[model samples]
Target: MKRIIPFILALLLLAACGAEPVEAEASPPPPMPTASPLPDYIPPMDFEPVSVWQAEHFSGRALLYLGAEEDGVTPFKVYSCFMYEVTDYLDGNMLMGARAFCAEAADSGDFSVDCSNRGLWLEPVLGASALTGKLSVDGDRLTLEYTGCELAAWAEDTPGFEYRLSGGQPVIDSGTGENDSVQYLPTEFKRLPDEYLGRAMYWMPMFEEEASASAESVRGLRVGDTYADIVARFPNPLDIWSRDPRSVSAPDGWYDTFYGSEAGTVFAALFYEGGVPSTVLITCCSYASFQLDGGLNITQLSVSAR
Candidate 1:
């Protein structure tokens, strides 16, 4: 009886020691935060300014002279003075050019003359026909004074109206008992496209060359080509200004389109008929007008170079 009692006590102690421990439950990790979505991105508009050119148009009687002496001076019926700042694209050259329209019969009742062909010239300085002038700048204003400037009616009619500038002002001797002076001021100025001005003034010859090349390349685009095909052929244009369908004119329809750079150094106009190109006009330092047939084939090509 005593041996059986001792064995039972030892078995109970072994069972308690072998039992597993009870552990407290652990809390799950805090849930991760939801990420916020980002806003959509929009592209900015492209704009690049190349240079500054300003002109002032004046009517009525105005005297234009180069230097002090008024030799070879002819009275102008109409006058237009211009100032060009080519420092941005050119080698910091400031030039002045003027156009004076002289009427053959001042009393013939007509004061109109075509001044479109008249070209700009570098205002002479001190009896010299220099290509550029000295520029002076004030607040919102620029003054270009020429020493020995030359004035003329046009390229064809010229002995060269030569005179010396006294105070950057022209002495308007009306010869009617009135002596008044007029100064050039650029109050109303318009910023012209850099490309156009560069080609027109011969400031950037390479721009002209590139424009010519682009025009020639685009000419290969046949009249039957789609707008997509045209874009594929000529990828980068300055911009596509127009893309309106000809709904009213023809049921087949057409589109009048213009493509060029911001400066307008070179540009092309494509007229699409029946959703196909019919005509293409390219202008770069000159103009090339192309007419196409119904098959988008080149039928007529007229090119003019300046």
Candidate 2:
């Protein structure tokens, strides 16, 4: 009976020591969300070729420039600029208007950096405090988006303070596209009355009377008059240039001179009415010129000093 009992105990121990296969449970991977494509309504850049009128409401040729990241990067940044030529508005007070300046992040960079880097050059025309907002490039349209900025420095004497002078809207040129060569349009036409035409050319000069000797003014003299005559009667000019009616070009050597110097230069000339000299207008430096209503007047003029 004892031997049988020992044998039974050994059998039970062997059965208890036998091994069995165990199963393992795996962990599930984290989920990944799909990304959506960019919207179709937005353009690649803001600056597209277009026509813009002058402060005087005369038609002028306009072109825009936009700088964006060519390299592929997220949350891209951009810079924008504008160039316009007014040929025949305001009796040619301004031959052209050019604006090349940039606005950085509202939260990034020193505020005066813009002034030193770009605004100082454009301030005379655009005002020093005018640098406000991010320039957006939406394909062919150039949009100037204001960053909720309101400072006394940007305020102008004009009615409503014309924020377009300071901020707002896209200056679009419908004529230019991806394949088209850029060009400007004239602000004025050939047929116009003398008094109105004289006003067109002489208005800015007339308004400038209150300015001190440091400020520049225009003198209406005959075409045949010598340079001495120009200097003797009018205030001393910082610089002078002559305009050719045939080509609508100034001695500043056409558009090339304007681009090269980047300095503010003036073009002066005598216009004839009924075969008689009528008025003398100064061609204020700008980027483009266009024919709009009467004779060639400057629709856009650059006030910045290089």
- Assess every candidate by TM-score: 0.27, 0.26
Maximum-lDDT candidate: 1
State each model's CA lDDT, in order. Answer: 0.34, 0.29
Provide the RMSD of all predictions against the true structure, rounded to 1 decimal: 24.7, 31.2
Segments in model 2 whose C-alpha atoms lie over 4 Å from true places = 1-59, 68-98, 104-113, 116-125, 128-130, 137-142, 148-306
Q: Candidate 2 on 1-306: residue-level lDDT in tens? A: 989999999999888789565567655322222212212111123333122211212233222222233333113222121233332333322233333333333323212214332232233223334334444333433343443322235333322332232222323222212111111221112222323321222222211111211222223323333333332332223333233233343343233231211222333344444433233333333211221112323222222212
lDDT of 1 at 3: 98
The lDDT of model 1 is 0.34
